[model samples]
Target: MVFFNLWSVLQWYLRPFIKWFLRKTTRLCELQRICYGDKPGAERSRNVEKSLMLSRTRDVKQVVSYLDNTVLERSFVPRNFPEILNPSVAIILRAKKINPKLHELFIVSFRRCLAQIWSYRLLLEEVEEMRKTHYDSSLPEHEEKLLKLWSLLVPNEDLESRVTKQWQYIGFQGDDPKTDFRGMGLLGLENLLFFASEYPQASSHVLSHSHHPKYGYTYAVVGINLTSMAYYLLKDGSAKTYMFNARQYLPNMNLFHKFYCYLFYEFDKMWIESKPENMMEFSIIFKKFENAIRNELADPASVFRINIEVDTI
Candidate 1:
C-alpha cells in the first residue's frame, strides 16, 4: 500500500513535467517543419506557427476574428482539444511559454477559442440528444404538462376541443399541434413551455404580437426558428463572444435558455419595429437581425440580458 501510494504521488508530481515536455516536443517539431519547408504538411505547420505568432501580437477581437475566419471554419483543432488543454490552466501555461508580456491577450484569445470549442461540442450533443428524444404523447405527465402550458398561453381557449384553426393563432403548423414539434422534438416544447411558464406575461405578450393582422408571424414557428438560430450561433462559434463577454467562462443550459428568452422578446420587437410587408420577408428580416446580433457580439464587453421593462407586445 505504501509503495502504491508513493508511486501515485510520483505520477501526480510528474504530470505537469510530462505535459510540458509533450508541448515543447510538439512546438519543436512544428518549428522544424516551418524551417525545413520540405514535408507535405509543413505548410500547415507553418500556418499554426503563424497563428501562434499572431495570437501574441493581435488584440482580442483580431485574434477571435482570425480564428472565426480560419481555424474554426476548417478542422484545425480536434473536438477534444478543450478537454486536453482544460482552457483555464492551458491559458496560464500557454502564456508562460508563448509570451508573458501579452499574457492578457493570450488568455483572452485562448479563452474565446476554448469557449467556442466547448460550446460547439455542448450544442452538438444537445441537438443530437433532442433529435433522439421524441415527444411521447402516451405519457400522461407529458401530455398534462403540455396542455397546462397551452392553458397558460391561451387562457380563453377551450382545452377539450379536439381540433381547431385557433391553433394557427399561436403558430402551430396544423390543427394537431403535436406535428409542429416534430422537427425540434421535445426540446422545442420545453423551451416554449419554459418561456410561457416562467415568464407568463412575456409569453402571452409575444402571442399577442403573433396575432397582429399586418406584421404578425407564427408564434410557435418563430420560436422554433429562434431555437434554430440560437443553435446555429452556438454551433458556428459566434455566440462565443457573447458568452465570453457575458460570463468570461463556458455557459450551461440555463444560460442558453435565458439567451433564448432574450431572443424571443427581442425578435418580437424587431419584427414589429421593422414592419415587414409579409411573412415571405421573414428570411430576409431574420438574416438582418442575425447580422445585427453578430455585430453586437463583436464587441468584447457585450452582454445579452432579458430586459423586463421592455413593453410586452
Candidate 2:
C-alpha cells in the first residue's frame, strides 16, 4: 500500500513532464501518439482513457466525467452513444489543438475507442443498479420478470405455482426462488432470461445438461453463480479486454448478458467433460472456471462470440 501510494504520487508529478517531452519530440499530443501507436482495440481504449484521465488539462478530465455521467439517467440510449461522444471527442482534440480534417483517421479511431471505453462505464452503472435490487415477491415488475424467466426456460409447461418444487427443476435450492436470489439479486435473473430468450436453443441445451443423471447440476443456481462471477469481473474492470475487443457488442445490458451466456455455456461443457462426482465438487470447479475466465480476460486481444460458438442462429 505504501509503495502504491508513492508510485501514485510519483506519476502525478512526472506525467506532465513526460507528456511535454513526448509532445515535443513526436510532434503529436498524448492522445494522438497513443492512438497512433496502439492498434484500435482494448489496449488502445485502455490507454486512451488513461491518457485523457491523467492529463492535467481540465477539458480532458471533464471529458471522462461527462461520459461517466451520460449513462446515469434513463434517457441514455446506446444508439446515441457515438452522437453524444462527438462533442467530447472534439473537446479532447481541441485540448491538444489537433485538426480534425488533418487527422481524420485519428478522429475516427478515437471515437470508436471512446465508445468502447464509456460504454463500459455505462455497463458498470447498470450492473450496480441491478445487483443492488433484491428480488421482491411484492413488486409486480420483479415477479413478472421472474415468471418471464421461467417461461423463457420452460416454455412447454406452466409453473404449477409461484412457490413450488418446480423451482428446483431449474436448479433453485428451494421452492421459493426469492430466497436463492439473495446474493446476486435481479442481475442473476436478468442474465438467465437473456440466455433463454436470445439464445434459446443454446440455453436449452445447457439447461438439459443440468439434468444429466451422473453430472447433473442446478441450472438456475449455476447461472446465478455465474452472474455473481460476471458481476465481479465487470466490477473490477477485468472484463475490459473482452468488452473492448468485441466491438460487435455494444456495451449495454445485452452485452453483459451475452458475456454471462458465454460463462454458462462454457461451464456446462467443462462440468460434463470433467465428470465431477457430485455437487460437492462444484465449489472447486467453479473456482477453477472463474480463474480460467480471469486468465482469458488478462489478454487485451481476447474477444467473445457466444453466438458464433453456441447460438443456434
State the C-alpha lDDT per candidate: 0.64, 0.86
Task: Estimate the TM-score for candidate 1.
Answer: 0.61
Give the distance in Å from residue 159's predicted Cα in candidate 1 to where it truly belongs: 1.2
| Cα RMSD for predicted model 1 | 14.8
Q: After superposition, how far is residue 132 of candidate 1 from its true place, in Å?
A: 3.9
Q: Name the runs in model 2 displaced over 4 angstroms.
A: 1-11, 74-83, 307-313
Q: Ten residues in a row with the worst lDDT in model 2?
A: 73-82
Candidate 2 local Cα displacement, residue 255, angstroms: 0.6
- Which ranges in model 1 have alpha carbons more than 4 Å from their true place? 1-120, 248-250, 311-313
Candidate 2 lDDT, tens digit per residue, 274-310? Answer: 9999999999999998999999889888887775656
TM-score, one value per model:
0.61, 0.91
Model 1 alpha-carbon miss at residue 60, Å: 22
Q: Model 2: clashing residue pairs?
A: none
What is the C-alpha local distance difference test score of candidate 1?
Answer: 0.64
